[model samples]
Target: MKLVVRVKLLPTPLQAAALEATLHACNGAATWAAQVAFERDARRPLGLRKHAYAEIRERWGLGAQAAQHAIKKACDAYTTLKANLRGGRYGRPGTKRHTRALSKPVVFRPEAAQPYDDRMLSWQHQTRTVSIWTTAGRLKGVVFTGQAEQLAVLAEYRQGESDLVRQGGEWFLIATCELPENTLNAHPVGFVGVDLGIVNIAVTSDGECHSGRRINRQRENDRALRSKLQKKGTKSAKRRAKKRASKEARRNKDINHKISKRIVAEAERTGRGIALEELTGIRERARLSKPQRTTLHSWPFAQLGSFIAYKAKKAGVPVVHVNPAYTSQECSQCHHTARSNRPSQARFACKVCGFVEHADHNSSHNISRRGWMAWVCGARSTAPALMLVA
Candidate 1:
């Protein structure tokens, strides 16, 4: 239930310059840390390394306090690397996470909102411009509201539990409030299935398909234009490239927003709990080429899920995630196993039971069923799942 609300910073030219300097410092610290770590690891593959703070102060000429901060960041990266290794995720070598690279200098929590202060503020138009104390500050366009309302609610419901995060950059937060405990149905509402596909961005188990506006044609045209510009390699070409990047980014975000909002609306109207596959791992599957992988990630399924959960909670609805095992292949009616179930992208035909349905609908149905099974087996609570089914 942790959420991060982000807002843009409207800074003066001088302030913007200061922010840029802060980013440079953060990047410098990261580069220095990376170099040190790389050298140490190269010398001894499993060598015990010096403390980040001590090394930063000694080798990078940073103050004790500044050294401590850099060391803490390095330690966080170390923890992430170790966790990834333990989880069998050996990919590209560690580098500065984008958020870490573009972070701003620390400012006093209370003074953080002061316009003159280096730190940025997160404001809401309540009775007036209300500001909250947050640890996060502006790096680029995004600023994470560290003192998030959702975090407060989570702490109240689940004491002492915390979600570690590094956020800030073109992200916004939405939250669900006034959530009720399990009280949806006599038998309890169960699951929601979500199918992510290319033709349609999402297909819900609830008989609703969220269609994506076909932009592939437009993207191809844009790519062709970029290729032409690359051949020219002129100043105008560079300007066109920047313009294209900005335009495409905006268009993609608009698409994501529409898709996510529709899913939330469906969940509220249908009263079904939500189910999402652990998509983080699936993005790395070898079946997809680099471009295909990029397209899959570009769909913003995770962001859509987050939107649904928070919006559902506000309407006294809930969401639950279940394992996405053969949701695409398993026939919803007879549990038949075969690739033939999905002979085409849009259609599903059951080989075992002669049941047929739209490919997305079948996946949604199976997702709902799996969530109910999990609930009955006491794997998780019933309230969240009931919202979707009821």
Candidate 2:
């Protein structure tokens, strides 16, 4: 399993200036290369390199590797644009949006992240410093910091390329580490089904619930503050709003990481696999009021799912995605499906068997059973037998 570890880089004023200059030069070169490719209709990296490599080195005064990287970045931008165009991301062909996207060559920000290979960057884990090649010169003894665990991983498994990123006036080196996966547990004792919801955030078949009340409350406060800032329409206010948005995202990501770590640890300890609800197209399938829709769309259910998946992969725990249709309203006891079975968002009372249970708990149990059927029994029924959680 490959994991990305981000470490903060603290550089002296001179080093910072060099780094800044390097970013601007690299991005400017890349933009120029992109224009060349656009004019000549040269999308292939090697062919485009032949056209722009010499110019990049001379015009930008970049090193050989940096020049190659700038050209490669330009080629990659075109490749991404091609994919987005094929996927109709901007719009269908002939539409104004689609035409506008293709009208000009893609341009990169001056502070855009640049990749550094081993020849261009070196890490000293013991000293917590880095030595990197800059356009001005080679910078040495640039201090850096990261979590203890990430630092250890970087020392051991860090390989290939690391990106030098400037975010919010701070420099960071995002390095990729290839961590070995644990031995696979092909036959699990059982499955831990986790039901994702707005109120609870997550409810496992084991009846463990992670409440989302705090998160939602804070989110509402952030939204209110951002709205006020937007109405103010000042440059400082807009900057504050952007910073607040990034802070909120970081907080939410931390919460998801904590939740996923706990879930994966529990499943591994109990020799169980995880079962998740396949929520693809959930936003389109469900109907809600405007306010409810806002809350629903704003929740990071997909991020939580992905967190669980990667953590489970690292732990060698199998994860299965079961159909989520009617999971909320279906009774775990009688397998009866009806809208009326769910008296409210939090309560489930089966009309057929008169079984009363927490809505999310029952739903999780159904998901757990379905996962077991899919994994152990090879039964991929749309509706599997449900029962009380063990």
Candidate 3:
């Protein structure tokens, strides 16, 4: 499995200036190359390189590798844009969003992250320093710091390219680490099913609830602060709003990490697999009021599930993604299916057998049983069509 490790780069003022210049030059070249490709309707990397390679090298004072990388980056952006168009991510054809996206050539920000190959960047794990190529020259001996575990991972498994990023007045390098996957547990005693939701965040078959009430409060506060700052309409206010947005994202990722670690640890210790729900197409299918929609859109259910899956994989714990349909509406105790089984958002009751339980907890139990069945039946573990046949 591939993991990413981020470490802070403590560059000297001169080195930082050189990095800034390099980013500005590379992104400028990329923007120019993309514009040329869009005008000529050229989508192939080879074609773009043929047209813009030497130009970028000479005009932007980039070396051979850097110029090629810049052009390749522009081509990759177009590829992504083309995929988005085909996938209806910008809306269907003739829609305002889709038409607007087609109206402009792609542009790169001056400080956007840039990928560096081993030729351009080298790390000194023992000394906690890096040597990176910059516009001025090769910037060497730039000190870096990260969590102890992350540093260890970098030393042992770091591989391939790394991205140099400048965010919120700091420099960071996101290094790719190809860690070995643990031996998978083929025979598990049971499964720990996790139900992900906006209110509760996560509920396990063991009746453990990881509430999102506090995180929801924090999100609301963040939204309010950003709205107020944006309304103030000052440069400093806008800057603060950006900072808050980044901070909120960091918090979301941190919380997901903690939750996933604990869940995977518990499953590994108990010799049980993990079960998650197939929540694809949820945003498109769900209908809610404005406030509810805001909460749903902001909730990090997918991130939590991904965190759980990768951590479980690292721990040799099997993971199954079960069909989410009717999990909340079906009664776990009596196998009765009805919309009325969920009397409220948080409560479940089975009318046929006079059974009741917390809604999320009941859903988790149903999911766990389904996971066991799927595993025994040799069905695709992550298939979304593993139907519940209660």
Go through the candidates in order and give each one's C-alpha lDDT: 0.53, 0.87, 0.86
- In candidate 1, list every pair of residues with a backbone clash: 189-386, 205-364, 271-387, 271-388, 272-387, 272-388, 272-389, 273-388
113-135 per-residue lDDT for model 2 (tens digits) = 99999999999889999999998
TM-score-best of 2 and 3: 2
Cα-based TM-score, every candidate: 0.57, 0.95, 0.91
Best by lDDT: 2
**Candidate 2 lowest-lDDT run of ten:** 381-390
- The lDDT ranking, best first, is 2, 3, 1
lDDT of 3 by residue, 179-234 (tens): 88788889999999998887888889998888668888988898888889989999
Candidate 3: lDDT over CA atoms?
0.86
* Residue-by-residue lDDT tens digits, candidate 1, 296-352: 765556655655655555554545677776888899888987888889877899988
User: TM-score for model 1?
Assistant: 0.57
Q: Candidate 2 — number of clashing residue pairs?
A: 0
Q: How accurate locally is residue 61 in candidate 2, as Cα lDDT from 0 to 100?
A: 97
**How much does candidate 2 score in TM-score?**
0.95
What is the model-wide C-alpha lDDT for candidate 2? 0.87
- CA-RMSD of model 2: 4.9
